[model samples]
Target: MKQLNKILLFTVLLGTIYACSTKKDTVISRNYHALTSHFNILFNGEEAFKKGIEGINQGYKDDWFQQLPIEPIVFDDRKIVAPTFKNNSLGAGFGSKKEKTTTTQPAGPFEKAEEKAVKAIQKHGMNINGLERNRKIDDAYLLLGKARYYSQRFVPAVEAFNYVIANYPNANLIAETKIWRAKANIRMDNEEFAIETMKLLLVVTDTLEADLPNDIKEQANTALAMAYVKSDSLQKAKKHLILATRTQENKAQAARNMFVLGQMYANENKKDSAAAVFNKLANFKKAPYKYKIHANIELAKNVVNDSISSSVLSRLEKLIKDRDNRPYLDQLYYQVASLHEKNDSIALAVDYYNRSLRAKNGGDKQKSFTYENLGNLYFKNSEYQFASSYYDSVLNVSTDSLALRIRRVKRKYKNLASLINFENVVATNDSIIRIASLPKNEQESYFKNYIENLKKQDEEAAQLRLNQIAFGANSSSLQTNSKGEWYFYNSQVVSFGKTEFQKIWGKRKLEDNWRWSANASINTRNTDSVNVSKINTRYDLASYLETIPTDKQKIDTLKIDRNQALYELGLIYKEQFKNENLAIRRLERVLSLNPKAELVLPINWHLYQIYNKNGNLEKSNTHKNVILSEYPNTVFAQIIKNPENKIENKEVVNEVEKTYKKLYYLYKKGEFKNVLVNVNDVLPTINNSKLKPKFELLKAYAIGKYLDKETYQRALEFVAINYGSTEEGKKAKEILKQLTKE
Candidate 1:
């Protein structure tokens, strides 16, 4: 009886397994496969798809300065790979694993979702007698499309979306599939097609407005707005963004849309409208903290001086004191600084700018703006060194997208660098020359004092070394016991042995002559000999005195260089820095040095301008008469004769322009060598004219076209260094950057 029962149980199990086969065209087989696919495989697939979406959203960082995309898909243009379907379902957990441990294995929740989706189709799909019976196949396809979309495989994602749209037209996910299709189109740079499809989706949804879900309506509207934004139709985008925000399904996106709408109004110069929109966002209770904070900043920016109330300042102060807003202090401080600047409270503005820089978590963009603002402020005050320092900070923090602004800052900083360099040279040389003019006894006394200071430093350094060695020896002793007597077992003893050996043998390498002094001598000869020679020279007072410049011709040449640098610095302070007092001091020094005849006219003219601007009529007349009597044929004399002769200067500019036009035409005609010769011939004649930069730039271009790369680089470098403030010079710098990058 037991044997019979076992046989019967085995037979019943076999029959049940046969009845569940998906190939059978029966009620039981179809329902069984459908239930298994929907409740088991497809259920897990949908969950994986949702997790993938969460991962994407959590990883994406929105740049609030730019308009936000409807979806948070981060696309990588270099990662275009064809989608391959896996047969095994074991890899379905790929999307759920947050931490990836291996590079060789496939990862990401989206890839897992795709694997589960493929498994469902392959293992449980039932198609019998030319008819498909699986009910959850459409859901599987929907999941597949979304997984591909999030994975940044747009072409494959489109194929999946198209499959669902073509094969499952009456499915519940058809509308969503269409929306996904349009999004994929936009990512593929098919904005026109996306726009058309979204418009059609909108019309269909409008007809079924009562039946369609609110989230669907919101998605459609937001997709249309993104499409319009891509096409640069901000007005049209604003309308759709308004509709999308009204749905309130996605609070973060709604806040972003409202902010972009306000920005659009600001861009169009609708100050009142922009203020109203930003104020509405600021009052929104559920908006993200970032959006609300930035809205308040926009409101502050739009505040007109005539209408600014006490409440405005009070509101900003209250925000600054709020502990919860600490993470956003960088932007808040910058906004406050801008407000003070607008009110002409320069001291307060500078304080706030410094506060912004001191904030712990400031974004690079905000820090760059703060640095640039400080640079501009100091530059306007004629503090070129301080301004250059601030501008350097700006460049260090600025991003590559700020190319034009970076160019302008670099040009200004380069000019300031030149002025600073020449000023330092003049000051240093003047001090040296003054010391050199002293009597021999005084010079000896100065050298003696300097040598004494050096001796003191050497003594202090020797004492420090002795203290460090003592500390190291004590530490080594503490780290050992009686075992320290063994050189190989004790680290300190081994170290001491090595050092003593080196002191006697002088770094003898392991070789046949292990103890011969001459064998070790080769190792120490080069470095030790030089160091000993330098130490001997440094300690000898006579050697130190001999190092001072004493040749008459060399001293005279240095004096000339000093006077030239001083004269250039004076002109820079007057014209570039607009600091008349500093210019007067430098130019007066040049006059005292007995500057050359060529420099006297310009220096006197500059002094005249400076004195005239300061209302010193007597001093201005003195310089003006000198220029007129001594250099009557120069441009300075002509300028003094008729200060208001605009027509004459205009005519001179017109002639230069004509020359530039002719040379530029020749350049365009491929006469590269001729262009170079003509530009050089015309440059010296227009040394002080405004057209010199244009002529020099033409020459640079000609050199680049006809000469070797090294020569071209040198020519561009010359323009960048000497004529950096001009537009042509900026172009030269940009080209040089490209060449270097290549």
Candidate 2:
């Protein structure tokens, strides 16, 4: 029994020692756990950094990578912002170079491993008990900061880099830390801070200790170049980039720097320097600045065709076929088109122009400019009708449609008219030639039916092409009735072109029901605009052809049509469009064209109003004096010479109505601009008169549309403010304001 008790004591003592030994072993293992033990945990980040650099250098095409916006991953919060990376953090087979123990990491990205390292630090940043505490923690934090910085998150990036600086003063990566700190500063748009940090790096460059790696020095200088590029200081960029290109170990990176240097020189118009660099890059057979090959073609365009020979064109043609060259076909085709056009090769130019149009999809703004150029080329060659149609095609996409279309269409119409007449002249000349050459009877037979057939064919084709394009531009929307079938409304998208352009000066008849029922007078504002342009074109063409034709009858016929158009324009401006100045100008041109009696006092009264509105006090007073003095009983002069003496307000309405009755008679007699002025002088006094609003709007329309700039402003403002409730009043306000703003 005593022996059994001793044995129990021995067993209890052995149990206690065994327990202590097990606890110590557990503590040691926990303290010395190798990185290889957590291989999956630490392999992510290192693999990521390596793969990212490779993919970047591989020249990212539209991969899952390039489409993404670059988002940096931050550690403290373990959050990733947009441009989030895609696929795995690193693909399989990373970190194979490192040793593989249990804690030996599986090869993966630096980023993935860094992630593990980060998690470890987050839990133990201040816990200095283990081997991975303090310096290792500091290194992990610095590594984490760099990873975030490379991911393009400047704000969070700045935080990570700043952490390393604050916590790792004696760390081995301190020099790298300083350069990275500068890099972060550059990304933050703090170039001054970056420059200061970089300069300090330079001072440490030739340290007595002979310390940091040359690659780090190279990186620091590269950062300096980037900072300069951001600041738009190309000279500074050139100096530093030159250092990197020469001193850097990486040939591809050096090539990239050279390409940038060339681009900078190209932008500054230093062509020779640019050309040399580009040619060198072009010869670098495996260079990856894919866009650089495109610039060489542009540079070729500036080589000036002093001889305009086959060699230059041949040289250009060769450049387009380079296998690495198809991406910039738009530019290639444009230059070729320009070259062909310069060489007087119209068909070639047109073909290339079309190619250029087709070469790009929606990628370029140059497309519209190219189309307009082709249209103008055809226009200037006097293919007016074709040019006009081409310009219309341009208008479908053009931002400046109104002004451009009018200019094109008016030119087309005038040219078409002239072309028709020129053909007649040609026919007449051909007839004279035939009569001179043939027997008289044969001449008549030869000329008569041939001219007739040709005329009919030309007329049909011209009418068909013009009408189709004009009408095709206007498409309709359908409205369905309760009966169910839809009926199309006549969509009135007017192809007014020259007609509307003419209204800029005024020339249409007062079409019936043209005005909204809100006012007394008929409105032919749009119609009037159309007519005026036609009249002006008619006048111009007829007068232009006078000297070309020797026959008295031809000149006389031309002169008659010319006079008619001028008178029409004058009347259109004075009455239909209501531009007293335009009316006066048209009337004066009519007088110069020597029109028959109808356009005289209309001209004088228009002159009177235009002068008054223009603030030409002398001309206004003089015209009033002339009318009151010479044409004494002329009602217009009397009204102008005596505003206060005239009856006004409600009484003025009756009085002016009577006066305007006589003025309307004058208008009917075609003194429209004069009647407009007379009507205006009395409109203010009888604002409530039914006659007053009509005449006020009419006068405002005339003055605002063509004569006085500010008269439109004043009239619209007054009508809108005083008669805000009336529809005519609102329209007058809109049109008046629009006219004045113009």
Candidate 3:
């Protein structure tokens, strides 16, 4: 009887297991699939989707200087495709080195969620009489769409979203799915489609009184703003961004929207409105630290009155002193520097700029701005050397987006380089000439002093080496045992062994006959030999005297070059830099040097203009009369006598243009030599005219066409240096750069 009862229980268990099969549509089957899909598969999928979102948010770094995207999804401008799967079986002990390796073997969380969603739909989805009976199937589809969207598979994501909107119209997640589709469209550069779909969604939500969730409304509004932004309609974008900011679903996104709205207002020159918007963001307690800090800085920037400026400075100082704001010191110091500059406190501004450079966690962009500001200040002060150094720092830290500004800075730096080089040459030559004029005994004394300083430096270096060796020896003795077996581990012992071995055997290589001094000498033939007992000529008094230039022709040539450089620097300061004081100083120095007759007229003309601009009428008239009376036939005097000569000069420029056209025609007709001859003849006549660069560039082109590479390069370099400010000069520089690469 017990065996029969056990058999009945076993039979009942089998029947219950059979009734749980998903093939049937009874209550047990329906509940089993529904429960399994919702609780088991869909639950894990939803968790994975949430974790995927968290991962994306953690990885994304927003550039707050630009408008922020509404979502955290990182869309690559490059095309993305689904990864192809390959199952290659390697031989027993062999694998291809070309095989790719990744840290994470499986897909990311979103991809995992997508897989699970597909699995649930394939395994547990209930389709009865052309309807999905399992309600969780719609959720699985929504999860799939979201996963695909986050994974940047926009086309697939759109397809998934479209499937839901077409087949599951009455589902609770339909509105969200439509919003997702619109966002995906935007990602795919379908802004118009996205805008239309979002508008329809808004109409439907209002017409049906559906009462969509706040997050959905925020998303729709942000999407519309993004669409308008893509279309370059900032006014429309501002309206929607404001609407999105009010929804308060995503606080970070709300802060971003508000920030963009303020930037738009500022762009439209609505300073007060922009300041008001930024103030709202700055005062918001829960905004991200970045947004809050930048908003505050923006507000400070808008402070126009002295009273408001004082308050802003105090606030910025307080921020700088706060320990908790240490990470933001770079930006705070930059703002303080800007404020000081606005107040014309140049020294304080420079100090703050240096402080910003020293701050920790300051981005390259911020450092670039600081360097640029310092460069501008020094440039304004006519400190071209210091300005060039600062500009170099800017270039090191600046991005390609500032290409135009960087090119301008680089051009200015080139001019500065010329000035600095010529200034250094003049100063060095003057010092040398002065020293050369001293008596032989005094010159010997100077050489002796220089040699003494060199000897002292060498002695100090030798002492440092001895101290280092002694320290190493002492430390090694303490660490090593008395046994010679541990000698190899001691650095001092190793060094001593090497030195002693070298002294005895002379330098040798690790090869046969290394002990033979003759063989060693032959082996070390390529190595440099240091002979301590040998006297260097650089330290000898006679060699020093020999280096002082004594030839009268060489001295005169140097004076000529120096005067020419001074004259060029004067013109550069006058025309390029617009520093009249510096130009006046340089021109006066040129006159003191007794410049050539050709430079005197131009120098006088520049000084006259400088004095005129500075309101020194007496000095201006004095120089003007000198040019008019002494060099009346020159272009300088012609321009001063009648300003109408400028229009006549344009006619002269037209004649030069005709000459250039004739030479260009010769170049095209394969008469390259004639082109060169004509260009050379016309260039000197137009040397004082703006057409000089044009003529020189034509000559360079003709050279490139008719001459060897060296001649061509020389011609191009001449054009680049002499006419650096012209378009033709820029083209020459670019061509030279391309040739150098080849």
List per-prediction Cα lDDT, in the order shown. 0.76, 0.56, 0.77
Deviation (Å) of 229 in candidate 1: 2.0
TM-score pick, better of 2 and 3: 3
lDDT of 3 by residue, 485-600 (tens): 45565665557656755544456678884433334444333458652332345445677877877788877777887787787677677767778888899899988788877567
lDDT winner among the candidates? 3
lDDT of 2 at 264: 73
lDDT of 1 at 729: 68
Candidate 1: worst 10 consecutive residues by lDDT? 88-97
Q: Which ten residues in a row have the lowest lDDT in candidate 2?
A: 63-72
| Full ranking by TM-score | 3, 1, 2
Against the true structure, candidate 3 has what lDDT? 0.77
TM-score of candidate 1 against the unseen true structure: 0.68
* Model 1 bad stretches (over 4 Å): 1-35, 64-70, 78-106, 126-135, 208-211, 266-279, 293-327, 361-365, 399-402, 430-560, 577-585, 608-620, 633-742
Per-residue lDDT over 93-170 for candidate 2, one digit per residue giving the tens place of the 0 to 100 score: 112212242455534444554565565454323332322333345555656667666555555555656666665666
